[model samples]
Target: MIDISQLNYSSADFWQQLTHLLAWEGVSDAAVTETVRNILADVKKRGDAAVVEYSCRFDRLNVSTMAELEIPLNRAQAALNNIPVVQRQALEQAAERVRRYHEHQKQDSWQYTEADGTVLGQQVTPLDRAGLYVPGGKAAYPSSVLMNALPAKVAGVKELIMVVPTPDGEVNELVLAAAAIAGVDRIFAVGGAQAVAALAYGTETIPQVDKIVGPGNIFVATAKGMVFGTVGIDMIAGPSEILVICDGKTDPDWIAMDLFSQAEHDEDAQSILVSPDADFLRRVSESIEKLLPTMERQEIITTSLNSRGALIQVADLDEAIEVANFIAAEHLELSVDDPAEMAKKIRHAGAIFMGRYTPEALGDYCAGPNHVLPTSRTARFSSPLGVYDFQKRSSLIQVSAEGAQPLGKIASVLARGESLTAHARSAEYRLKS
Candidate 1:
C-alpha cells in the first residue's frame, strides 16, 4: 500500500500542509551553478574546441572536432523513412496537427493612422534562429520535438537547430524522425551545459540562436538559467505535476491510473487528487496498490506517490477549484460532471484537461497543443509554449509633422521633469518654434 498523504479541507492546518507539500527547491545548488558557469565561460571563450572537449568528456564520445558532432539533415529524413510505417505516420500526423493549431496563434503586423496623420501599430517578427535540446540516447521523446520545433516553424523562424546527446554513440531514431516531420533545419549530437553554451555563444560550427527550448537535466537547466540574458529561454521548468479534481463520479481505477501517469515521470513528479467523496479516495488508493505492481516503472511510481503524491478531501468542487487556483499545477484534470463550468472558474493552470474522457496524456501527445508548459506554480504568471514564444513584436510609431509638435511637447515635459536636459532638448527640437 502506498503511503500518500491525506489532507482534509476542514482541518485548521490544511493550508499549511498543502503549502509544505507544494514546496520544491528547483534552484541549482552552488556546486552545480559554479560548474555551469565554468562550462559557459569555456564554451564562450574557446568556441568549438571547448564544446568538443566537454562532449567527449561528458557524453563518452570519441570525437575530435565539432564537425563530427553535427548530424546531417538527411539523416533525420532517413530516420523518418526507415522507421516503422505506423511511427512515421504518427509523427507526421502529430506534426501536422501541432502546426495547424499554432497557425491560428500567428500574429500579424498591423498599423492604424490617427486623425493627425500619425501612424502607430505593432510589427510581429519571428526569431532568426532557435535551438531545441532533446534528451537523447535511450530516452525517445518525439512528442517534445514536435512540441518545441513545430511552434517555431509555425512562427516562420528562418532556421531551427536541434541538439541531442548521443551518449556512448546511441541515438534515438524517433526523435530524429519527428524533427524531420517538423522541418528542423539542422541537427547536432551534443548535450549538457556545453550544448547550451554552444547555442548561446556560437561556436565554429554551431551558429548562435536567438532562443533555446526543450527539456534537459540539472546541468542543462542551470546553463539555460545562466545564459538567459544572452538568449531567450522557455520557462525553467520544475518536475511534472498533475492535479485532478474529481466529483467522485469517475472510475476509481481510472483516477488512480491518471495520478500514476505523472508520477511515473520520475520520483520528484507530483500527483494529487481532490474530491468530496471520502470513500472514492479510499477506492482510488486501493486501485493504486493493486495496479502499481503491474507497471514497468512501478518502483518509480511507488517512490513518487509515497513522497509527493496526495489524496485531498475537499468540502466540494468549488473548494477543489479554489485549491487548484492556489496550487497552479502544471496539468489539471477536471473529472467532474460539469467540467466545462469548473474550467470557467480556473484562473491558473498550464493546461486543463476537461471531463473524465480528456486525460492529460492526450494533451502531452497528439492533442494539437504544445506540451511544453509552466511548472512549479509558474502557471500563475506564464503560459504554455506557443507560436507567440518564437515571435517578437516591435511597436511602430511614425509621427507626421503636425503630430510631432504635440508628441514632442509631451516628451519634453516628461524628460524635463526627470531632470534630463539632453533628453528634453532632443524632444523640444521637434516642437514648433
Candidate 2:
C-alpha cells in the first residue's frame, strides 16, 4: 500500500521520505568486501589453482584445468543452432539494432593542419580485448549479452571474451546463441569473483582483457571494483530502478504493472511514481494490490515495493519533473499528456521513455538503447554503457616551426609558472630548433 500526500513538502522532507522508501542507504556490511579481497589475494597468489578451488567451492562445478573452462567453438555453434527459430530471430534482431546504434557512435582518427603548419587532431582506437560478465544463476539474460558485446564489437575490439557461471556444468543455449550473434570470440564457463579475477589477471586459460563490461551480482560487482585499476571496468552498477511521471491520464493498472517490472528484479530495486491526480493515485494503489497476487514473483515484488516503491502526489507536472531530477533515476518514464514536451525538462536520467506506448521493459530488451545503465543516484553524474566504453581517445598534436613559436612560447610560460624547468626547457628547445 502506497502512502499518498498532496501537501507542499519541502525538498529535504521529500528527499528524506524518498530515501526511506527507496532504501537509498545500501547494504554497508564489509563482508562482501572482505570476501572479495580475500578471493582476489588468493587469485593473485596461487593463480589458476586459486581460481579452480574457488570455482568448485562457490560455483559448485568441477573445473580443474583450462581445457575444462574453455567453451568449445563447435559447442557454442551447436547451442546456437539448437535454439528456437523465433528466439534466435529475436536475438539476431536485437544484435543488429545494438550494432547499428553503436556503429553511429564509432569515432574516426582525424588530423587537422593549421595555417602555421601545425597539425592537431585526435586518434580514436579500440582496446585490444574486452571481457563481458553475464550473470547466470537467477536467470539468463541474452539481452545483456547483446548490450555488452555489441558495443565492443562495433568499436573493433580485437578479442571479446565472455565469462558466465554454470553450476550444472552447462551454459544457457540462448546465451551462447546471443553471444554468437554478437561475435563473441570466446566463452568461458566461469562466474562470480573468480571469473572476474580470471579476466583481470590472465589465467592459464582465460586471456587478460583491456576492459570489462556487463552486469552481475554483489560479489561480481565487488570483484570488478577491486580490480578496476588493473583493468578498465564500465562502472560498479547498483540495483535497478524506474521512475514514472504520470498526469493521471493513463490506466493505473498499466502504471502499477510498469513499476512492478523493476521491483521484481531485486528487493533493493526502486520503483516510484509522481502524479498530481488523487483519483489516479488511488486507482494505481488498488491496481497494485490486485496485480501483486497475480505475478509469479509476487513475494519478491511485494517485498521490494513495500520497502522501495512509492507514489508521490506532486503539485503539478513541473513539480514532478523537479522531483525526478533530484532523484536522477536510472530509468525515467514520462506518461504525461504530452510526453515529448515533458521530456525536454528532464536532464538527468540514464534513459528517457516518452509516450504511453514506450515501456521501460522495451528498452531493457530491444529498444536500441543499452540496458546497462547507471543505477541508484549515479545517473546524476554517470551514463548508460555505450560504444565509448570500448574505445579510447588520444589527443593528437604536431607543431611545425611557424606553429611551434607561438604554442611553444605559451607552453614554456605555463611550464615555468608550474616550476617545471625541464618542461619549459623542452618547449624552449623545440621553438629554438
Candidate 3:
C-alpha cells in the first residue's frame, strides 16, 4: 500500500523522498565499478583471450575461439522463417514504423554563402559501424533489436553489429529475425563486459565500431564508460523508471498496472505517481495490492514498489508538474483530462504518453519512438536513442579573398586577445593577399 498525504510538503523533503524511490542511485555501486574496471583492464591486456574467459565466467558458456562467437547469416535468416507469421508481421510493422520515423530525422550536408563568397555549412555523415547490445539473460528483447538497429539502418550506417549473450549457445530466434529485418550486418554470441570490449577494441571476429548504442547490465555500462575514448557510446543507462501524473480521470487498475510495467523490469526499477486526488491515490494503492498476487513477477514488482515506488499527493496539478519536471523521468504519462495541455508545460522527459489510453508499453513496442531512453534523471540533458546516435556532423567553411580579409582580421584580433601568436600569424597569412 502507498502512503498518501495532502499536506503541503517542503520542496527539500519532497525531493529527498523522491530520490529514495529511484533506481538511479544504486546502479553505480563501488563493487560494480571495481569489478568492471578489472574486466576492462583484462580485456585491454589479453584482448580476445580475456573476452573468451569473461564470456565463460559470466555467461556460463564456453566460447573457445573468436570464430565460434560470430553468428552465421544463414542461421539468422533461418530463424526468421521459423517464427510465427503473426509475430514476424508485427516485428516487420514495428521495424517499418521505426525506420520511417528515423528517416525523417536523417540530416544532409548543407551550405550557405555570404555576399563576399564565404561559404559556411554543416556536413552530416553516418558512422561507418555501430554496435548494438541486446540483453538475453533475464528475458529476450526483440523490441530492443528493432529499436537499436532500425535507427542505425535509417541513418545509413555502413555496418551494423549486434551482440547478445546465450548461455546455451543458442540466440533467440525472434532476436535474430528482428536483426535480419533491421539489416544487421553481423551478430555475435558474446555478451557482458566482454561483448562491449570486443565492440570497443575489435576482436579478431568483431570489428571495432564507431559508436556503440544499446542497453545491458551494470558491467556492460561500466565497460562502455571505460571504452568511451576508444569508441563512442550512447549513454550509461540505469534501471528503467516511470512517472505517472493522474487526476482521477482514469481507472485505478490502469494506473496500477502501468506502474507495475516498469517495476517488473527489475527489483531496482522505479515507479511513481503524483496526483492531487487523495481518493485516486488510495484506489491505486488498493488496486496495486489486488494486482500484485496475480502477476508472475509479483515478488520483483512488490520489492520495487515498496522500495522505489511512491504515491505523492500534491496540493494541486501545478505542484505535481513541478515535481515531475524536477525528477525528469524516463517515461512520463499524463493520465488527466487534456493531457496535451499539460504536455506543453513539461520541459524534460524521455517520452510522454498523453491521456489514459497510451500506456508506456505502447511506446516500448509499436509507437514508432525508440524505447532506449536516458534513465537516472538524464532526461534533463540527454535524449532517447535515435538516428542521431549513428551520425556525426562536421562544420564546413570556405572563404574567397574578399571574405578572407574581414574574417581574417576578426580571427587575428581574437587570437591575439588569447595570446596565441601562431594563431594570429595563421590568420594574418590568409589576409596577406
- Residue 333 of candidate 3: its Cα lDDT? 96
Give candidate 3's TM-score: 0.95
After aligning candidate 1 to the native by TM-score, how far in Å is the CA of 270 from where it should be?
Answer: 0.3
Instruction: Residues 1-433, candidate 2: write the lDDT tens digits.
Output: 4333232344558767665565465443599888988888888777778877887888788767767877876787787899999988888888888888878888899998999988999999999999999988657899999999999988899999999888767578898888888889998888889889889988777889988888888888889988999999999887899999899999899999999999899887888888888689889889988988889988788888777777788878888998888888999999987988888899899999998888999999888988999887788899888888889999998889888898889999999999999999998987765
Clashes of 1: 0
The lDDT leader among the candidates is 1
Off by over 4 Å in 2: 1-12
Write one digit per residue (lDDT tens) for candidate 1, span 161-267.
Answer: 99999999999999989989999999999999999999999998999999999999999999999999999999798999999999898999999999999999999
Error of 3 at 268 (Å): 0.9
Note each model's CA RMSD in angstroms: 0.9, 1.9, 2.0
Whole-model Cα lDDT of every candidate shown, in order = 0.94, 0.85, 0.86
Q: How many residue pairs clash in each candidate at the backbone level? A: 0, 0, 0
* CA shift of 354, model 3, Å: 0.6
Residue 388 Cα positional deviation in candidate 1, in Å, after optimal superposition: 0.5
Q: Could you tell me which 10 consecutive residues in candidate 3 have the lowest summed lDDT?
A: 1-10
Q: Kindly give the stretch of ten consecutive residues in candidate 2 with the minimal lDDT sum.
A: 1-10
